[model samples]
Target: MVTDRRSEFEATLTRTAEARGQEAGAALQRASLLRDAIHRFIRNRAAVVAAVAFVVMVGFVILTPWLSHGSAYGVDFAQAYKSPSWAHPFGTDEFGRDLLVRTALGGRVSIAIGFAATIAIMIVGILYGAISGFAGGRIDDMLMRFLDALYGLPYLPFAIITLAIFGTVNFWTMVVALTIASWFTTARVMRGQIITLKENDYVRAANALGARWYRVLFRHLLPNTLGVILIFVFLELPGVVLGEAFLSFIGLGISPPKASWGTLAQDGYSAYEAHPYIIIIPSLAIAWLILSAFFVADGLRDALDPRTRET
Candidate 1:
């Protein structure tokens, strides 16, 4: 009886050791993958430059207003349309507001809206898609049909309607307007990924082990889809920025006295002929940000793709 008990104890010990070994191996593998992805991203020179430029631009926008100790709303007609000089590098706008300060402030608003809306989009899309895909029956069909219906709605017009319903067009309102229709694409992509991933052996094993639905979804499914999520975030940012800019340009976004890149461009539109730099500076800022975002997204795509990972 003692011998039998010892034998059982040994078997338990062996199983425990094997489990630890497997867990350690998985941890190492994950670390190696992350390291390789970073290396790949660093090797892409344009992406590296773009990432740096984006960080610099963000810092500039955030700090410029604070360091200048100036209000974006401050206007002085006497200094109106002053040419770029020692006092104001970007010159003055039609209202005689400092273009540099206003441009920086505008960037803050635009970038903030983009990020806030993108986060909201990701949260809604991920949860909806994950649940739908995992359920995989009438529920999936219903959810997908609803998403399809949303897809038919025109993006800008829908946003306009959303803003109208809120009876205001401000930061949070813009985020909601952008998030409403924009999440459809993300949901579709995530749903497709979840469907494919749910059939994997590990996922099946997780289910067989009686893990909770939320645990399986968050730990096993969503973790595996990180690559897709990261790529989508960078790709979506530029669209959100542009959308906010477009709405603001049309007088439905951030109101006057509050600056946004779109509003700055709108403010400068009529004066472009006599003072072309007013429009040119803000437009250039928008173009640079979009280009940088795209390059970073491309780099992340290549880095995270197993097929493209360097051996």
Candidate 2:
């Protein structure tokens, strides 16, 4: 038996050697920045867990219709106001719609709005902030003053007033309202970061080399600020989701049959005294997701920040 084992080991080693001999040697490749970031991100256990949880919840939302009664919009007079039970896990709404289905659908809409608004914010905010910071002097002064003026205005009231002026609301309108309200901080943060980076030697060198200001900002500065930007994205998503919910709750957001979490919460609120689960379930879903987003943001900040790497 020992002799057979030795022979098998020798055969395995021989096979390995032959395979290596058959393969051509190549130059070692330099590590990529993106690869390094991925490695660092994976190493952050909290971030990974949060991201996994978030993904699973999203998957659950996507698959809920298939997994359950499979009808988000279908009203069943039979199941009206039913509490958590084997048939309907999340209970039913006043319209006899499945609460589980409605909540999942609401989550989808809420998450979509959050991401959409974030994208809008990132585009306008990053550009506005970068330009403001890079230009400095009078242009920066003017922009900063304008932003400050916008800041002093009562925010939610302004949004409510704007929505009222329009007289009718929908998903797109809600997203636009949220984006318009929420992008100020991102711009301010980006401007501050760009201002700090503007005087750096590399930025000056890029400018001296006749590289366009935009090119320098995009290529050299943005990459360096990516860590902060990504962290901001995670942190901002929850706020946007909550804001959409708030607007919808107040009837200033997506109206009628198109339900977001806010609308569901509003619908749930009326009967909550009698059937608490209807409201509680959607509320918990929102809270859990927002908390998960915060955890991801915190983890990303710690993992991605070069300044924090040494610690």
Candidate 3:
């Protein structure tokens, strides 16, 4: 009787523990999984500084122009080449327009292009990669082959060629060109991630439970891959902005009256001997924006890395 009672007591304790686990598993899992990442990200000094700087820069670029009555294109030859002052803090360009206003407007355009292209690229690449990875076999082979063909093409030259053929690259045209050139990387990354994840025990369990292919891919595989994708997204933006600026600098980006940082810098370069501030200001803006993005990406990678989670 004593031995039987002891066995029953142990069984009762096991049952009680399982019941408590079932009640709190989700909450515990969520906190355990996310808390470390969040804490690490918050503790990153450079990342926090960069984040604040980026937000401030973007807001100043966008709101400064709107807050004032100055036109980015308004010419005042009388005030030409005036150095930084209260009337023109960034000074006057060759056209005698307020450099501050023009630079801010340029920032607006450059950042917009960066964000729009990244978003489009992410959506297309994720879908293509998820489909290719989850539906492995001949279908996967064909899709990957197609991706390879696109990936092998020269991105910069092809974008230039497309712009030349079109003869009128507007905002939408540039967005499309950048999207086409950039999505290949995301597709490659996502495909590899999904393929490995699909073989994991959790994924296998979901499949065994009669989850549809689409559900498994989108609901399970996709979310798991998002941390990597998001990190890449920020990392890609700086490159996109730089590429757009380079094109604009060469006279191929969005045409005049619609200034980009590249155009602003290019214009500033014309009278550079007399007024270097014009060029200097826009160049500083670009560097700051790109560096800030890199800082954030580094922070994100550190936060999400499982190896670093314990620290």
State which candidate has the highest TM-score.
1
TM-score of each: 0.91, 0.85, 0.88
Across residues 101-191, which tens digit of lDDT does each residue of candidate 3 receive?
8889989999999999999989999889888888889999999999989877888877787777777888878887888788988888888
- Alpha carbon lDDT of residue 146, candidate 1? 92
The pairs that clash in candidate 2 are none
| Top of the candidates by lDDT | 1
Give Cα-based local distance difference scores for all models: 0.87, 0.79, 0.84
Clashing pairs in 3: none
Q: What would the per-residue lDDT of candidate 2 be over residues 9-127, giving only the tens digit for each residue?
A: 99877755543432211101112444556777788888899999899889977888777864567777876888878787887887788888788888888999899989898888898
Candidate ordering by lDDT (highest first): 1, 3, 2
lDDT (C-alpha) at residue 121 in model 2:
83
Off by over 4 Å in 2: 1-40
Which pairs clash inside model 1? Answer: none
lDDT of 2 at 39: 75
Residue 118 in model 2: shift from native, Å?
0.9
Candidates 1 and 3, the one with greater lDDT: 1
